[model samples]
Structures are given as C-alpha cells and as structure tokens.
Target: MQPDVPTASCCGEADAYFADEIHVRDGKTYAIITDDRPDEPRGRPHVDIGTEIEVPDHKLKWDKGNPTGHGIIFLSRNRYVFCYVQPGGA
Candidate 1:
C-alpha cells in the first residue's frame, strides 16, 4: 500500500526512500521515478539505473528502509537505481 507513494522526495540512505526487492514493470505496474539527490546529486555518476549489482555481505542491509537492505544499480546513463536486496540477516 505504501509503495504507491512516489519516491521523488526521498533520497540519501532513507527508509521511505524505496521499497523492498519487489519486482514491477517499469512502464507498467509502477513507473520508475527519480529525483535529484539534494545531498549528493552527482553521487556515483558512473552508475546507471537497471544495472544488475551484487551485494557485499557487509553492505547488504541499508541504514533504513524496513531493515530489508538496499542496493544501487546503474541505469541508462548517469543515473543510479535504488532497490531492495536480500537482508543481511537473511
């Protein structure tokens, strides 16, 4: 139910930033949305969205976000995708 809320306002290592490792059609179920990272807009500019990434054992769970962990994947160009990953405790 909460996933329906837009993530445009969420950035940095925040929980309300993203959802769990739930899959959805980019152009269908829910549109992939993005917003400038106010704290670090140019953070990791090399990475893009939709890129697959392996999680580091220590870097699994993020600071927030349901304690479900999150990871970043590269996208088309200078964009980074924020998504869920297997929780470290899992």
Candidate 2:
C-alpha cells in the first residue's frame, strides 16, 4: 500500500519546491529524493552524511533520531524533509 501523500498548498512559489508524493515506513515519512536545487549557490557547502540538520519538529511524526529529539533524519543531500509549514512556502 502507498502512503498518504499530502498536497502542498504552496504552489508556484518563488525559491521553493514541493513533493508530489511521499512514503512512510517505520513511522518515519520520506519524500522522493533529490540532489541540489536549481537556485543553489555555486559554492554552497554540502551537508555530509550523518550530520544533523534542522527541521521543523512540530511537523515531525516521530521522535528518536537526533539532537532535536524529532525523528526527522536527514541522512543524505537527497533526503527532502516533509514539514507542515515548509520554509518559504505559502
């Protein structure tokens, strides 16, 4: 069975993107993976594997992974987090 893919109310917004579908497994939700953004800076630093990244905890569904105590884990640059109020989104 497929996970419930929520609709992103923020569409056509500037400097932002949204996922069309997502998958939930082991109580953790994940979206389709991506690498880098079109507007990404040329020399922007890349986040390494296992490094803790900040994510909206309120939108997170689980708690057991990182410093935030929110189970939202960003294990790769391709891991796009699914949050309730996306940054720069409407």
Candidate 3:
C-alpha cells in the first residue's frame, strides 16, 4: 500500500532525471529511496532520488507530477505500490 499523494513539500514535480524507488515497510509508512552519485563522498548511502533501482521481479514506472518524478511499484498481479518524495528535498 502507498500513502496519499504527498504535499509539494514532500514530493517534488516530475521529470526524466527524477526516477526513484518506493519502499514499503510492513504496510505502514512509506519512504522513497534514491541513489546518489556525488563527485565527493557524502559519507552516506548512495541511494537518492532519480537513481535507478532493481525492484524485485516487479516492473516500475513513473505515475504523475512534474519537476520531480514518482515511482509506481507493481507488486504481484494486481497489487501496486506508489512511491513519492515528501517535498522540500529531492
């Protein structure tokens, strides 16, 4: 399951470079995982918005919005997971 369309503060607009992954935790709160490829070490994970991820055997794609892109998680046959950024940050 996915949360409501997060406010602009959470999810940014959509774009080609705005690819991301939707992570689901026991059907509760949702978080967006992205990959980061900084020239310098950020001393953190490389997962940042727009980073391509391998989502199991499921197929993913963009859903809606502009400026930033959102990922739609396809779980199984009819199950689906919607991933979005919480805005303010990319």
* C-alpha RMSD of each candidate structure in angstroms: 12.0, 12.5, 11.3
**Model 2, 1-90: lDDT tens per residue?**
001234432112232233323456666544432323443453323443333334434444332222322122222235344342222221
- Score each candidate by Cα lDDT: 0.31, 0.33, 0.33
Better of 1 and 3 by TM-score: 1
> Candidates' TM-scores?
0.26, 0.28, 0.25
lDDT of 3 by residue, 1-90 (tens): 123433312221121123344455554444344433451343322334643334431222234333333333222212233333232223
lDDT: which is higher, 1 or 2? 2
lDDT of 1 by residue, 1-90 (tens): 112223333234432222223333442222222323442445433322332333322323234333434332222232333333333453
Evaluated against the true structure, the overall lDDT of model 1 is 0.31
Error of 2 at 31 (Å): 1.4
Highest TM-score: give the candidate number: 2
Report backbone clashes per prediction: 5, 0, 20
Rate residue 40 of model 2 by lDDT: 48
